[model samples]
Target: MGAFTRYATAGALVLASLPVAASARAASATAAPAVTGAARADVTVPEAWGTLIAAGRAGKRGIAFGDCPESEMLPESLRCGTFSVPVDYAHPFGPRIELAVSRRAATGDAAERQGALVYDPGGPGAASITFPLVGEWSAWRKTARAYDLVGYAPRGVAPSPALSCRRPEEAAGTPTDAPQQPSYAYKRERIVLARAYTDGCVRAAGPALRHYSSLDGARDLDVLRAALGEPRLTFMGTDQGAYVGALYATLFPSHVRRMVFDSPLDPDARRVGYRAGLARSRALESRFGDFLSWVARHDDVYGLGTTADAVRGHYDRLRAEVSRNPAGGTVGTAQLQAAFLNAAFYDDYWAMRASALAAYAQGDPEPLVTQASPRPYTAKGDENADAVRTAVECNDGVWPADWRVWDRDHTRAARQAPFAAWAGAWANLPCASWPRPRQDPLDVRTGRGALPPVLVLAAERDGVTPYAGAVELRRRLYGAVLVTERDAGSHGIGGADNACVNTHLETYLLTGRVPARDAECAPHREPNALALNRAVPRGTGPQHILRGDPAPAGS
Candidate 1:
């Protein structure tokens, strides 16, 4: 995994699994005919769902709140707690697991207080318990004040009996040296690592590994909604988190008040893992081009090249040098690729990344090493983040069991997107040997006229989720309005300080006003070193800074 591993590793699983229809339908023949455009009055909420909510409200087996573990970065007003849910929802009283949750109450006047606004921060594994704090400190402050910002560590994330595969001590070492061109030996080593990681997960989590799919996370969300006493959920899910929100809306259409999907995953591509991975690789290639152009524009500072091709040549040579001998005994070809791949996610890192690359080329590897440093685990359970990322993605859909298929697809992809194709392939290869039986991909297409108008935000050049995913999500969710950030490649759209995007987002969250038709926003000015340094909050890492967090202490 690399610096942007959480986002980049979100490729698809197997393409052969059956598709589970996620849309909700009226349970009675007497129900009115389905409406077309506006919110329908005909859809009926299931009685069983009502009964479940009642049981939770009566405190029979509902979530309980308590003081959160103290964190100076977080306000004392935030509440943290956990609730038990069946590992297999079908067996409601069988084996159970706890879901860690956090809530920041509305700061606005009680008269203007809206319901809770739940958020999922992209990675199938990204811990969200700290998202409320992120909102409080970023451009989302107004939205956070009006609605109680709700966050939860989806099953198998930190503080929730996380899914750990290997201990830090058991971590495998990657080859310090690689040939200029990828060799069969390199591919074989990658497969061995993938299989070893998969086996470790099987040993660590046992049968529960099969239950950590996105569908399962959506079910846990419904339980949280019931416990919170909210009639409907207002949600904002980014990246893979967008997949969870889409699935949730499809499963409980009548219970969705407002929704936003930022840099959304393509629900239609869930069954075809290779197709999705290829799309992401292409997007990465395009974004890398953008990065190259940016570097060329600032040739005075970097002194690498005056054109994109020249800069790319320098990059190629640097990569080859590192592959021949790992810089500082750690920065190999993979680490170098990871650092640059992360820079492609947000242009805010462009100057820093370019500076590091320049320094590395000048016989100084320390700066690049700092940029490629692994995010330290903040809690005992935090170590399982990657394991959960693997388990959820692997269990989500059927992956090609044959390595030949992966080999062929990634090989083809590398021709056009050499930067990320091979890296993404190895990152997702664990699914080929995942221990559990694969679950069917959810049919995220909403029933006509079922869901309310959802607001979709996307950067035209976003590589992680890609712009096309937002388009596909709009088609899947009827009446959804999409707001595209023209010429922008940043992955997270909301709260990124783009007035156009944030205005659209804030309007929808505050008053449920969606544009009559799809809209486009001009991209914000590109970040320069001076501006970025000023924009980034104190005491946060580069990743957290781009994620709109004020501090790096929380999940």
Candidate 2:
């Protein structure tokens, strides 16, 4: 809602849930082309493409000619390359931008290998080029071997003409309002900050801002599909990546072969889909209750409280104390909330978060601070990550331009999900004043057109792209089947360790089948609580950065 956490890494695993497809078939290389460049079929290629085409085709693989960048640390089997496409699809052959792509060839028998599986790891901002790391995810190992895995840097993200504000430090700044009732001055400060950020983004990104939306990314995917010599796209998208996949399907249904939309955003077609943010706030509040219950049950271990209210009281007290005297002079109430919100996103982190909180209550807060510190916004090449996130979201849909709307909504949500509502609102405040013209939100239903059966997976307790949104997507796509992981408090269930979910996922990726009906699966057994707690040594700050991904919007 406010900002999706960058939580797609690590615990983002998929498992078996729905029954495996009845049959499996290897994709044929000779499948008829559905529609080449349907995404840009109406546009006329400019003369400028002639020379570019000749040079691109000079190599062994015409149009697909590319070699891995020397800078990339990837397996020898994976190849990387760059491709040029028009900045604006309608004006093909106009100004062009190069997008970086990495490919892992299918490991299955040559005859059984399917088309490339283009992936978008959500953040709308995070680099998808990290597919090499997917091996550790386990759930995707079979998928990785079954089809060529494709990862690309979305336009405006780093390594693809990233757009960073000239005042990178200011552009990278994050609003740090603690979880409390905001004073009039605090509200005004947010407004001013939002204006400043919007202005900086415009100065930094210039015309590039208009082409960074998910819609544009979808079109880019089609272009990449053509370049790969694929008849249709086979995609695996998680988090906001799911949103891009959904948009691509809606915009070019005939061009999709198979798609997996995991932890997807609700395909509500509205310009400025701020209501989804509200929906996420409600989900977070719901999961927070679960955290309270778990903490209460483990009171003997955490020593925080025996009742949920008592546990919550300890949290509130710590927040008040931090507000008065910021913990370690580095951590404040806002940082504390951000650090702990990770617990609500993944149950596996519950004990660690509880341990951090218990340590804070006993007068050591450094562990929490280390976990919640704002990400290094000014890191080289990353100054524009936040900016790209803002631009794409703002341009894709209309965020209410009026402060009053945001104030009312955030105020109501904070009452329940105090940990994230306001902070999330502040995360996207730049959208209110985004200079780009907003496009109407897309209606991603597949009922109007022919679309292959698609798969949608969600966790019953995901706070980022809540389960409700997944249900909505399942309903909108006539042939889509929804898979749920019961009691799994996670954002990306597909990448989770649940064997059941992984089995189902494998069946789908390897075969072209999903269960005929919507289905649910049990959560993977949690790790030993005592073991998890023991691992978080007592009376010491975290030795490394305890980073948590903010749940992304749309996806």
Summarize candidate 1's per-residue lDDT along 1-555 as a digit string, tens digits: 111111111232221222211112221111212223322221232222322332243233445667886642456887888776656644343455667788888888998799899888757677677767755465787887799888887777765666777775343233244333579988889889899998988777666677778877876776677667666788888888888888877766777889999888888845435567778888998999999998888888788888999889988988887778776666787667766876677676787778777787777777766555333433333346668878888887668879999988888888888888887887788999887566668677776668878999999999888888889889888889999999999888887758899889999999999999999999989977431111223335323632433322211
Candidate with the greatest TM-score versus the true structure: 1
TM-score of 1: 0.85
- The C-alpha stretches of model 1 lying farther than 4 A from their native spots are 1-63, 71-73, 172-180, 269-272, 374-383, 529-555
The per-model lDDT (C-alpha) reads 0.70, 0.67
TM-score of each: 0.85, 0.83
Candidate 1, position 366, lDDT = 73
RMSD of 2: 9.8
> Model 2: which ten-residue window has the lowest total lDDT?
20-29
